[model samples]
Target: MCILFVALEAHPEYPLIICANRDEFHHRPTEAAHFWPKQNRLLAGKDLEAGGTWLGVNQNGLIAGLTNIRDPELIQSDMKSRGELVLKALINDGIDESWLARYSPFYNPFNLLYGDEKALYCFDSRAKRLNQLTAGFHSISNGALDDIWPKMSRGTQAIQAHITNNSNPCIDSLLAIMKDGTQAPDADLPQTGVSLEWERHLSSIYIQHQEYGTRSTSIILKDKRGKVQFSEVRYDGKGRNLGRNDFSF
Candidate 1:
């Protein structure tokens, strides 16, 4: 997943809102938001190619998303399948940040987002080091440090500002550098780079997908009773429903 925007109990109306975009090669294997027939548990898109999911959620409002750290040099794939990382974190028995960090998942330098009723936190494992982002609101893309990627830096600022300045609705912001092979100028982004392009078409504010190549968008709304209502927007992105289905859980 490249670009993402998420709100974790950061607002009064909607406690958890996640909007993200996943960019990858056409050959990469992916399963959009749905209840896995074999597992019977709802999951975000899974990368059957890499064996990990970009994002997923359960019925109880347990949400988790993962983004890979891309570099010029290819990182050797470990024997442990990356797909298991999503199943490991998202299927947790509901743990806190401190507890989640200790998972020691298969991949290092991973950008992970995990949350339940109590709270949510973003984690970074750059250079094989893991750290829990301090509570409050945060965003991440792909880079050496937080808020450093060209477009992603702006996305981080937007997330904090939208969360701190407004609370009526809540802002959804998530960003990552992607090699989509299509270059376009974006308002949120001043200019586009050759290595990574700023793609607004792939961006979402409230988990709505309707354009080509866009797979699924999921949103979570938490009420004062500490309950959550989850919904998903799924599509073929090429304007075809095909066999696509969106499920919340």
Candidate 2:
């Protein structure tokens, strides 16, 4: 997942709301969101290449998502696939900070967001720090949790405004916010070790490119009654919709 917006206890009807966009190469093989046949309790899309998921939720209300840290210099070709972190988090009884701390070094830099509705935490592999999120709105991207990158700030404000205006927000409204393609001003772009052209291409909330861009958007809502609604929409490199999947449990 490239970017994720989280709202905890900020909505009257839903206690937890998550909207995330998975940005990757168009050629990567992926499976749409579904209840894994092997692990029926898990709901998520699979990265066929890595044999893992980017975001997922289990039968017991546990949620986990991951984002790569934008530090190209620290990436090692032999490092473990970060996608497995999400699966590990979902299948395990609960998050073990010590386990993460011990194994994080084996993988590339990343930020792991995992927990239940009652509480959520972010583990920063680069910094090796674990933080428990407070009740409010937050955004995470290729940097640390709640880093004020231009896209992160823009998306965060847009979702907060939508929630504040609509008493009961719908999946379409949240998906619209994630579809924003407006790029940030050149002066507002953060220097993340990429070319200026590449930076500009990735500045928008919804990236559009012939090679690397947003591949899917996932929205998850958990109500006060403990019921969950999960939705995922897939897209091509040209930003054309491929298909959508919805599940409730």
Highest TM-score model number: 2
> How many clashes does the backbone of model 2 have?
0
Per-model CA lDDT versus the true structure: 0.51, 0.93
After superposition, candidate 2 runs with Cα above 4 Å error: none
lDDT for model 1 comes to 0.51
**TM-scores, all models, native as reference:** 0.64, 0.98
Error of 2 at 22 (Å): 0.1
lDDT of 1 by residue, 1-249 (tens): 655655556666565656555545444556666566665555566666665677777655677776655543535556355456667666664435554355544454566666654666566654544444443455555543355444454444565565566654431222221112232255443222223332343333222233334454444555555554444444453433334343322
Q: How many steric overlaps does candidate 1 have?
A: 17
